[model samples]
Target: MVSDTLKAVMQKEGVVAIVAQGKAFPHVVNTWHSYVSVGNDSFIVPVGGMHGMEEALNHDNRVLVTVGSKEVEGLHGMGTGFLLSGHAKMISDGEEYALMKKNYPWARAIMNITILNAIQTV
Candidate 1:
């Protein structure tokens, strides 16, 4: 499940990175997303991207996401950010897919990332 703090930060900062494991290095794609809760400890984030996102997922299901804001200042003028690591399943069907399609009509594919860990400093 997504913690209230993380969810709040995500809501405040709607954009995040979907980083997938690559052969040489991690492939990162920035995207706008909508956060969803499937159940306890089962959080989902739907993202829209071109071929890279889909291709990366094909290579490895494990992914990492970095969220939060760089412009927002904290107590000590530090940037607020969060890192979410987890596994994701590529979805082209079902309600989540449909919703993603509806939200992002030009999206090539929709990735439903199940967040395993969420760390935030905001």
Candidate 2:
């Protein structure tokens, strides 16, 4: 289950650490911008400027997401963060995509993450 603290961090910061990797390359990008939880293990994050993600998204469907603390509240000096492992599916048109568009009107796509694990610090 995704803890309340993690969700709080996501809601409070609206950014996440996304890592996409393939056999020959690894890419990390912060905030395609606008992330929201649909359920305990499901989330939708808008993606823009996807040039860096194209290779990984094509070679793999799994992605790593880290949220909270330094990435979310670094400027505010908040402590800790969480890690989420999940499968991501790209969507350009759908209910989730519509919501993504509502939240980030300029986003080119939406990544629906079906979280399988949640790791956090005390």
Candidate 3:
């Protein structure tokens, strides 16, 4: 399960940058908005900016997401969460996009990510 604080951060503006391991080191991709799946699983559906981000997703699927409440004090309130491993795919179909658009009104666009692992930190 995701902490309330983390979820709140995700809902805000700006983008979440995910880092994945590559042949040499790591690659990064930024998403304007993300749809987090329920339960303990670590999955994220990153929405918006699909062009270049798709390339980064291809290199590596593993990702780490950072979200927090700046208002809160200490690292406990501002920490990072890990989505150890997962896959990323472009939501090219119009139907899929439409559904996501309907479901997530706040999101300009959407991507579906299946979580393989989820880790919480304080």
Candidate 4:
């Protein structure tokens, strides 16, 4: 579960990194984007590239997400870490895909991510 404060932090500082285990080796890809909470314990992150990045998604679906912001004044600041466990599936549903596509015009395609797990970092 994510607290209101943590969620706020994520909104400010969040980076989604995707890692896939390929046939020969493991490859990693990352990007920065806006993330929003879709449910009580779920978050949706739009991932671009529908066909070109198919290989990466097929190989592996494990992803690592980190969220945090810089310190201000004398306040003690810390970052939170979340390990997401969900497979990357291409948006096939037209209506749903269209909605995602509408938000990201620059992306060739988009994939909706359903967060499975979230953990706080020490």
Q: Which numbered prediction scores highest in TM-score against the true structure? A: 2
lDDT of each: 0.65, 0.72, 0.53, 0.54
Could you give candidate 4's per-residue lDDT for residues 1-122 as a string of tens digits?
55665555556645656555666775665666364434455555455543434576676665445554442111234544445555555455477656766776555445555566665553
Each candidate's TM vs. the true structure?
0.74, 0.79, 0.54, 0.66
Q: List where candidate 2 sits over 4 angstroms from the true fold.
A: 32-34, 70-78
* Candidate 2 accuracy as TM-score: 0.79
Instruction: Tell me how many clashing residue pairs each candidate has.
Output: 1, 0, 1, 0
Give me the runs in candidate 1 sitting further than 4 Å from their true place. Answer: 33-48, 70-79
**lDDT score, candidate 3, position 3:** 54
- Model 2, 21: alpha-carbon shift in Å? 1.1
Residue pairs with backbone atoms closer than 3 Å in model 2 (clashes): none
Model 2: residue 90 alpha-carbon error in angstroms:
1.2
Alpha-carbon lDDT of model 3? 0.53
Q: Which tens-of-lDDT digit does each residue in 9-65 have in candidate 1?
A: 555646767788776678887755344434445545455544666677778889887
TM-score winner, 3 or 4: 4
Over 4 Å off, model 3: 3-5, 21-25, 33-50, 72-85, 101-109
Model 2: which ten-residue window has the lowest total lDDT? 69-78
> In candidate 2, what are the lDDT values of residues 45-107, reduced to their tens digit?
677776667567778878888776554433336666777888877788978788768878988
- Model 4 TM-score is 0.66
